[model samples]
Target chain A: MRSFVALFRKELRSYFGSPPFYFVATAFLAYAGYYFHSDLIYFITFGFGLNIMENFWQILFVDLRLVLIFAVPLLTMRLLAEERRLGTLELLLTYPLRDGAIVAAKLGACLVVVATLLAGTLVYPLLVYHVEPFAFEPLFAAYLGLLLFAGVCASYGLFISSLTDSQVLAGFLTALPLLLLWLLSWNEAAAASGTLPVVRAISLFNHFQPFSVGVIDLRDVFYFLYATGLFVWATLRVLEARQWRGRR
Target chain B: MIRSELLTKYYGSVRAVGGVSFSVGAGEVAALLGPNGAGKSTVMRLLTGYVSPTAGRALVGDVDVAERPVTARRQIGYLPEQVSLYPEFTVRRYLGFVGEVKGLARRRRRAAIGRVIEQCGLGEVADRHNGTLSKGYRQRVGLAQALLGDPAVLVLDEPTVGLDPVQAVEMRELIRTLAGCTVLLSTHNLTEASALCSRVIILSHGSLVAADTAAELGRRLEGAGRLVVRIDGPPDAVAQGLSALPGVLGIERGEPDGQAGVRFVVLASNPEPVQRRLAAMAVAAGWTLLEVQVKPPTLEDLFVRLVGSEP
Candidate 1:
């Protein structure tokens, strides 16, 4: 447990020390802020209501998800890949650490970085409330949804990062799967009746839809948790496989 | 207390490290001497638990590295050949991180970091970023990290590969100060090995060709000391006379040493009497005897002989 904390602290320090964290953070905030302003304009033009907060939460959640698809990959591309490239992965393995602890530390630290970026978007909602007041319940649910989605994306990106030593390749490969999932739900309404439900079930955006509308569905929550677990597990396996290969 | 028995590793079909084994007692400094690709690094990796042996076992103290890597790693401090470091981390921060990961108590961590900073002569660069330091300083940082928790065994791979002559000497001196530390350093530098390590283990083509104290390996590999006699006499007659001397085993002609004397390398198990006899023969023949120097076997000679004899 101490090692985990130590590794976590190291991970966090590394993130803040590098330029990529600030670069991705700045880009995420700028992109989300632009969409937030546009969402605010639409909200003002459309006027406020009991449903205004729900719509606002949905817009914020969707824009945040879009920003994360790019941001998370950039943020996580170096989690393991950079370590491997720098040959520090071998050094880390020599430490008295369970591979799982190393993976968990990286995941935990990256989640914090992502959460900070998401937290910056909180100002948008606070600003909206001054001009047009709304309930907090839906906003809470939507933020929870965003956190879950970002963790899932971050884990997926981490898994990709563990697959190679090239940060560029990790980013590219991570974006590929995320874009596919995002596109799957994009045209869900026009999909064939037979495949529409299945497509929506697997689509990341669809899992966040209930929270966006102020309804906390257990099934959607479980899906994100399970997906995050799956990716984190996969990342651990990749790390273990690296050991097996390195031993030879 | 480090040992490996018949340790072997193969990357697919290419054997990186063949069945090789050696042990270093507690507080003893042993060197893994070999050429590039001769498995010095691989052997270090195996003992340090950076990798597992495919065919054999490594024991750090009583812990089996393959069976209990974490516990075994706890007893070992490793500095790989590359000296990998986080570029953005200052020397102090990096050492602190290593201390934390090694599970040192807060007070101990701070004290150990301080001690190592002084030990490795890294006081000046403690606040400097790792990437900004010179190669010699960077290697020092790597050494400092390895020394952080004061583990039972220190495994260093080519600890002085890229340093200038002065820095290399200083690095050797620094390692020498670790008098009671069990060190297993792999290096291609024979002088470094002879200067710092009491025991030398030579690896060639992934197999340990020899392992012994430097003096013993030198004497054993290069059988006998020889005397080089520079005599101003006819080559054939000088060779015949040198061969007939009571202590002379054989004599081989050498190029003249610019002073107009044909040189002969007289091989003899005992060079003391042979040197005296050759001088007397040159005097009896009225030939000028310029030089008769006995050349003792050296670690350099042993290294070249052993490494060259490999198929």
Candidate 2:
């Protein structure tokens, strides 16, 4: 537990001490904030009889997810890749800590950064609330969904990062599959009618849609958790394999 | 405090470390001397629990590294050859992180960090970022990281590879001050091994070729001292006379002395007697004795002879 905390704190420090974290956070907030402003104007002008907060937040959450698809990879690419490239991973593995602890600490740190970025988007909700009050349940559900989605993305990104020492390559590889999953349901003609439902079922977009509408389904939550676990497990395996395969 | 029983590691078909075994008693300093790719780093990695051996076991302080890696690692402080550090972290913060990973309590971590900082002479640059420090300071910081938690075993791989002369000496001095710690450090430098280690383990082709004190290895391998004699006489006549002298095992022609003299290397069990006899023979033969110097076998000589003879 102590080793985990120490590694967690160190990962946090590395995130805050470097330029990429600030760059990604700033870019994500700016992009999310710009869409939130435009979505607010669209809500004010065209939204009638609709719950302004629900519709506004749902749109904003979707926009933030889009930005995160790209931003999260940038954030997670260096987590393991940089360590391997710098030869610090060997030093880290030698410490009195389990490989799982190391992986959890890094993923935890990345989640914290992602959560902070999601927190920045709260200003949009606060601004909307002053004009008209709204239910907080859906808003909370939406934020949870976004955090879970980002967590899934981060786990996969970390797993990819563990495969190579090139951060750019890791980022590119992570984004490619995530982008495909997000776009899986977009093309109705790409799949046969019988296969379309199965494709939509696995799409990250379809799973996150229920949360946007203020619905917290256990299946969606479980799906995100299971995917995150799958990739986290894969990463642990890669780390363990280094001992047998020999660390470069 | 540290032992490896037939520890072997294979990276696919290529064997990085064969079935090799050695032990270092508590409070002893041993040196792993080998040329590049002799499995020195691999052996250290196996002992530190950074990598598992394919066969046999590594033990640190009664704990098997493969069975209880974290527990075994808790008793080891390792400094790898490439001193990798987070460039953004200050030396103090880095050491603090290392202490934390070592499971030191907060207050104890602070004390250990401070002690290592003082011990490694890192107080001057404690607040400086690691990337901005010089190579010497980086090496010192790596050592300081290893010194934290005061582990029973210290495995340092090429601890002073890139440092300047002064920094290397300072690093050696710092390592020398680590009393009561079983230290196993690897180096290509025989001088470093001779200076800092009481026992030298020489590896050739991933196998232990020799493991003993430097002086003992010399005595066992070479058996006697060597003498270099320069005489102003016929080369063949000088060689014939030197080979006939008592106590001389063999004689070989050495490089010319630039002056009008021939040089010959005389291998003898007892060099003082051979030196005197050669000088007397030079005088009797009316040959001027240019120089006659006894050359004690160094770790380098033993290392070269051992490593060079490996298939």
Candidate 3:
């Protein structure tokens, strides 16, 4: 427990002290803010009879999730890759800490960063609330969904980071699979009607859609949590294998 | 305090360590002396629990590393050859992190950090960022991290590989001050091994070639004494004359003495007697004996002889 806290603190320091985190966070906010402002303008001008909660904030939440898919890879690319590249992983592994503790610490730090990034977008909800008060419960559910989705992305990104020492390669590889999973539901008409259900069922977009509508279905929550656990497990396995496969 | 029994590691088909075995008693300082690619780092890694052995056991304080790696690692302090540090972290912060990972209590962590800072002479640059520090300071910080928690065993790989002479000496001095700890360091430097370690474990091709004290290895490999003599005479006559001395096994012509004389290295069963006889013979034979000195065998000789004999 002590080792985990130490590693967690070190990893948090690395993220907060470095430029990449600030860069990714700033970029994500800027992108989300721009779209949120435009979406608000469109809602005010052409969104007559449209519900502010569903039409304004929910649309913004969906757009923010898209930005998260790209931002997470950038945030997690260096977690393990830079450690290996700098040869610090050997020292870290030799410490009196379990492999799972190390992985959990890194993943926890990245999740904190993800949460911070999502926190930056709270202003959009504030702006919507000022126009007309709405139910906070739905907004809370939407934010929860975004956080869960980001957690899954961060786990996969961290897993890929463990497999290579090149941050660029890790980032690219992580983005590729995430982008594919996000786009799986696209062009549904071209797919066989029978197989379309399976494709949508596995798609990250399909799972995240209910959260955008202020609905917290247990199935969607389970899907994100299960994916997060699976990738986190994969990362732990990779770390353990390094002891036998030899350091690259 | 540390033991390895037939410890072997293979990276796929390439064997990095092959059934090598050795032990360092409590409070003993030993050197893993080997050339590059001789598996010194691999052996250290195995012992430190950074990697598991393919076949065999590495024990620290009677705890098998493979069976209980984290428990065994708690008893070891390792300084890898490449002294890597988080560049963004200050020396103090990095050491604090290491102290925490070492499971030191908060108050104890502060004390240990301060102790190592003082012991390693890191007081001057304790606040400096690791990336901005000099190589010597970086190496010292590496040592400082290892010294945390005061583990029973210390595994240092090429501890002074990149430091200047002064820093190297300071590092060695700091290591020397580590009393009552089993220290096993690796180095290809013959002088360093002899200077810092009481026992030298010579490795060649991932196998233990010889393990003993430096002086003992030298004595065993010496077999016969050697003497270097400079004579102001014809090279051929000096060589032939030295061959005639009793107990002189052979004489090999050496480099010129830079002054009007020739040098010869005489191999003899008894060097002191041979030296006196050669000096007397030079005087009677009308050849000026400029210089004659007994030459003791060195660890370099032993290393070359042992490593060279390996295929």
Candidate 4:
């Protein structure tokens, strides 16, 4: 447990010590804030009388998803890929370090980065509060939605990083899968045909929809939890295989 | 303290190391000498637990590398052919990380890092990033990393391959100081083995072709017998006199001057007859036989015999 903590702190220090953390987080947060306000103003001019839940749902769908979907790949591509390219992975592996510790710390540090980005968006709710002191239940749900979405994406990115040493390849590979999921449920003809239930279930939109509304549905949370678990398990498997491959 | 029994390693149907068996005890430095692809690195990897053997067991302190890998790994410090380090990290940070991974306690880890830096001559570049250092400094840092936690055994693959002549000499001196720590380092540098190792293991085509002390290796590879004789007699007279004698194959004389003037590298079928002839000549020539010691074979002769003479 102590070794785990030591490794985690070392990982976090590496992230903070490099340029990627500060720039990536700040840029994602600023873009999300700008787009959410723009999205809100555009909806208002259309005379859309969105209540607290409706406004939160609208911000959640367009703003958070757009920024997070793009930002996640940038934040996580280097987690394992850079270690491999630079041969530091061997340095870590040759030590008394456990594979679980390495995977946990990498995912945890990315989550922390995601947490900082989510924190920056708190200004959105404060701005919304000035217009009316209505209940902000839906916005709170949206924040939870944001956390789960970021966590799930980060895990997927880490799994992809395990597959290749090139960070650019990892980013592209990760984003392409998420982009496909985002579009999976939207192909109107497939829904009409009622085929490909697997594709429909795998889509990120279908699972994230309930949270966009004022509902913290257990089912949607479970979907994100399962997504996070499956990829993290895959990440662990890949890391474990490295030892086998290295052994003559 | 270290042993490998019939250890073999394969890279997908191609055997890099055949069934090679050898052992090294504490207070001894053994050199694994081989040409390229002679399985020197493969053997080192198997012993270090960096790679599991395809068959057989490698025991470091009675911990079988394939059976109890972590324990085996903990007892050995390995420096691979390439000094693979975290380039972005300074030498100190890299060692600290290595210390933690090697399971050293915090206080002892610090002390060990400090001691290894001084021991490997890495104090000058302790704060510099490992990537930016020169080849000699980088090799020292790699050696420093290997020396961490004071592992009982060190497995260094080509530790001095990239150094300039002077640095190679210095690196050899450092390796000599590590005599108490069981070392099995492979090098093309015969001079290194000549100066440091007590027993040298020669591998050819992944087999134990020769295992002996530096001088023994020299003698065995010399075919029949050869001796370098220095006497206080005339060079031309000695060369001509020795050539006329039976079993005296050749004699190449050095420049003459005073008592130590006449010297030559001698080749003969049998060294005993040459010794007798030299003793008789010393008495008859009215000159003293100052030095009549047998010179061991040169490294080139050893390489030809051990690696194969056809090349």
Identify the leading candidate in terms of DockQ.
Answer: 2
**Residues B242-292 of candidate 4: C-alpha lDDT, one tens digit per residue:** 777776666666665555558776666577777898778778888777777
lDDT of 2 by residue, B1-311 (tens): 88888989998888988888888889989999888889999999999888889998999989999999999999999999999999988999999889989999999999999999999998899999898999999999999999899899999999989888999999999999998999999998888988999888988888888887666787774656778778998888888888899987666687765777998777777788778888899999989998888898666656656776321
Ten-residue region with minimum lDDT total, candidate 4 chain B? B302-311
Give the better candidate number (1 or 4) by DockQ: 1
Q: Each model's interface RMSD (Å)?
A: 1.6, 1.0, 1.2, 3.0
- TM-score of the first chain alone, every candidate: 0.93, 0.95, 0.95, 0.90
Question: Higher-DockQ candidate among 3 and 4?
Answer: 3
Q: What is the C-alpha local distance difference test score of each model?
A: 0.84, 0.88, 0.87, 0.77
How do the residues B1-311 of candidate 3 rate in per-residue lDDT, one tens digit apiece? 88989999998888988988888899999999888888899999999888899999999998999899999999999999999999989999999999999999999999999999999999999999999999999999999999999999999999999899999999899889999988999987788888899889988889888888766776785556778778998788878889889987666677764677997777676777788889899999899988788887566656655785322
Off by over 4 Å in 1: A44-50, A130-133, A188-201, B215-219, B226-294, B309-311
Q: Looking at model 4 chain A, report the run of 10 residues with the lowest lDDT sum.
A: A239-248
Whichever of 2 and 4 has more lDDT, that candidate is 2
Please list all clashing residue pairs in model 1, or write none if there are none. Answer: none
Under the 3 Å rule for N, CA and C atoms, how many clashes does model 4 have? 1
DockQ of 1: 0.51
**lDDT tens per residue, model 4, A44-79:** 686366664665445545567868888999888988
Enumerate the candidates' DockQ scores in order. Answer: 0.51, 0.68, 0.62, 0.23
Q: Model 3, stretches more than 4 Å misplaced?
A: A189-198, B215-219, B226-294, B309-311
Write one digit per residue (lDDT tens) for candidate 3, span A1-248.
99999999888988898888888988999999898988888888888568876787778888888898899999899999999999899899889998889999999999998888888888777766797777778888999999999989999999999999999999999998777766665667766899888888877888988899899999999999999999999998898786668773
